[model samples]
Target: MIIKRKVNKEVYMYSIGIDIGTTNCKLCVFELLSLKLIDSYSFATPKINSKYGYDFDIEALYSQLEQGLIQTINSLSYAEKVKNIVIASVGESGVLINQEGEVVGPCITWYDTRTQKNLADINQKFSDEELYSITGIPIHSNYSLTKILWIRENCNINLQQVKWLCIAEYIAYKLTNQKRAECSLASRTLAYDLKNHCWSEKIQSAFAINHLFADFTQSGKNIEVLTSTISTKLNCNQPIFVAIGGHDHMCGSIAAELKPGEILNSTGTTEGLLLLLEKVNFNKSFLTSQLSFGKYVKDDLYTLYASLPSAGYSIEWFKRTFSVTDENFDLLIESLLNKLDDINYIKNSLNIFIPHLRGSGPPKRNIDSKGLWYGLGENSTLADILLSIFQGLCFELKNTLITIEQLTVTHHPIIKVIGAAAKNPLWLQLKADILGREILSCNIKEAVCKGGVMLAGYENHYLDKNAHIQFDNPIARYIPNPKMTEYYHQIFADYYQPFFEFKTSLEFKLKKDN
Candidate 1:
């Protein structure tokens, strides 16, 4: 993991990282020498509705990407000085493109529930353990395999005319006409063979999509030289290399300089805990707990992930429901903090929010699960509700961390907190108190995009692969309050654990009957 500085003739090099996120698309320009941000632009991703479920218009995404990238590049003093363009995108949302490189279908978003009906069939075809062994993914409809199956069953797609491409590959194809699937993103398809680093014949055959997938490419590998057409369209004259940057969380981990036994808690629209492993642990805890495995940016590495679909989403819901607008949101949370002088009183009166507004993730993987507020009363104030949401999210993350530790038999002493939620001091403190671990807040907000820039520099041979991967010193670190930590331990064991057990049991029974 040591990153040696490459003494290349190139003194100054710049790279553009286009982060194609679920909520918005961002293009970040970075100076490779200092890993400093040079420029950035963002645009909303268009969401569309299909007969079955929600989807992203691939053409629309590409259009916004082109606009944003061109604008960002134009702002640079030496526009043509940029050398690389790497893309990091949300996983599992893929589209079929025609031979002409035209999207034949919409990008079926991972959040869409249209594939729910196909889950039973998926489970019947492959046991949970069997699937996990092959692909490192538990049986779930959120993956591309189930979505592909759903499309085949519902849409009369002309299979022979199209090739499958995830959002990263699609963006790369648009730029350089190379259709190689980045390994990290490809692993999310549930048809990827993690051990072999290739598509799983068994999984593909099950869904009848044997020839649809693109050939695999190592993340950060230069797939193609930017096409002259794109260079002209972007008004850039430099020789630009187009590279695959992998899944967003994996990329974020790269920027975070995550190490073995360290967890990256990426908080965004959804929240996920990512851990890197040199070897796969197919223990019962992992298989039954619904932890997912995927390829890391490094070819020899793998990643384990568990997420709550509505962690941050639930907070947004509370804001809208309570009419907390963006301008006053921070003020309100600050006001709430001022009221909590007595930890004992706050903990005693606070409600427990089960943040599954969309659905639950891991262990249960229940789409039927709904958001719930427990221990609420007429005396409960806005402050209690706000704090409860943060508590609930941390509780979910703690449970996931516990499961990971049990499966791997390893303990992570500190959690690297990144993304939007990391900026909230109250939330960071709550996580440390609830999880009883040191919380290191990352100063860089665009960690995922920075990962793309890092990958590009590595690929272009300007970065030393032997030097230790170094991150900027953490902006701040929150230590757990001993009393609060001890109190939460008791609450977790006595209250949360029992409730989780009962809820999961009920969910399992319902799943069995259905």
Candidate 2:
């Protein structure tokens, strides 16, 4: 049992949160007393060797963080008020660090598709069921172990001289000079034993990756104090605690006020639907469908994550390709929403789209599946086409949600949405109507970053032991329109399902013929 401490209102404290994403990195400063965001900074993630594969310059990311950290710290009136710093990052991407604590190579991006060849070799070594049982992750190329093996096979790096560190761990190492792998990020490696909460000896021996991983540490565990060098660089007097925050989605879910029966829909460049479970439910059918189960930040909970790799990216693609004027994205979104008011017009029109521009994510891991726009007539307008994308994406999420409900024997009629897409009222309404559920907008612009702050506060004992740091009351709630919900039910049953089944059949036939 844990003892609760009484609050001290006289003391003032602050914490810093850094979230490293696929396309951007965000730094947030939170005032611990009020739990409010004081200031923030962000920069686009720099891509390296774009012509070959998607990779990030780890050094560039560190430089941005260093500058951002100093700037944010200077903005605060009292430097001593800053208490701790926590780092959160996207999974599956990590850097190889040498004995001298130097990055040996670029951090491979999870979006990179260069490890397909390594997948077959890995599959031959361990069956999918065995891999999923051990790691609680699907046997996919978009995992750190596969990418690391690919680099070893292709690059001139000496494995004996370096150890693998996830992006969050790399950042923590830079701040405190401690080589530690946070449990949440470590689970993404597809080399961790979820049951034992350590690196899987079977996977390590099979891949010869023994002694190439950092010490596995629990999330929210304070590993090191900020070094004097970092404190001097930031012009700070306080000794900051450096703690580990988990994967961005896990953090986002925490920020979105995750509950036992609720799901968090985090929509940014990509869209992820996360559900929290108190215990691990290792279902064979679920694992076979490629759904991932990993450790959540809370010790008692695990996360089931399903994603659409190109949800928002595909929307941006459509806007870039079709917009005639230099209209702002928000303006385009509002215009599209206004046009969606005419329900009968949309129903009469036959324009339809499939939201798989970057391959289908889970339940159907088909790399060859391409996005399709069908039944577009001469009467179809740009708004109609845009609405189709929204419909298709919602349908895709509904399918994923259904699978999750079946596998877990739980029902989440409402999903809390966060990030950029949560700011769009129309998108929220559409999700509610199509999914036939309520859409609660949490309105957290940088939930991933906020989650990092919350974790830091929890670790430092600034937050209440029983109270969750996430927003409890949603800023807005969207209820489904009965008519729209009914229509979408029919459309999903008659149109989306048939088309998806046909696409799967065609893809399989082509592969067999080849």
Best candidate, lDDT: 2
Q: Deviation in angstroms for 5 in model 2?
A: 26
**Per-candidate TM-score against the hidden true structure:** 0.94, 0.94
Tens digits of per-residue lDDT for model 2 on 1-514?
Answer: 1222123323668888889988789999888856778889999987788565878888988999999999999988766778888899989999998888877766788877788779988998999998988988888878998889988887788887899999999999999999998878888899999888889999999988888998877687778888999999988776888888979888887777687778899988889888877777677988867798888887567878897888888777887798635366566578867655577776876555778887787778765578877778888777667778788888888888888888777888878899877877878888999899989899975788787777666666778657755453457989998888898899889988888888878887997898
User: On residues 166-203, what C-alpha lDDT tens digit does candidate 1 reach at each position?
Assistant: 89888999899888888888888888898888898887
Runs of candidate 2 exceeding 4 Å displacement: 1-10, 323-327, 339-341, 468-474
User: Model 1 residue 28 lDDT?
Assistant: 91
**Weakest ten-residue segment in model 2 by summed lDDT:** 1-10
List ranges where model 1 is wrong by over 4 Å. 1-10, 339-341, 466-474, 508-514
Against the true structure, candidate 1 reaches a TM-score of: 0.94
Residue pairs clashing, model 1: 2-466, 2-467, 3-466, 3-467, 3-468, 4-464, 4-466, 4-467, 6-464
The lowest-lDDT stretch of 10 consecutive residues in candidate 1 is: 1-10
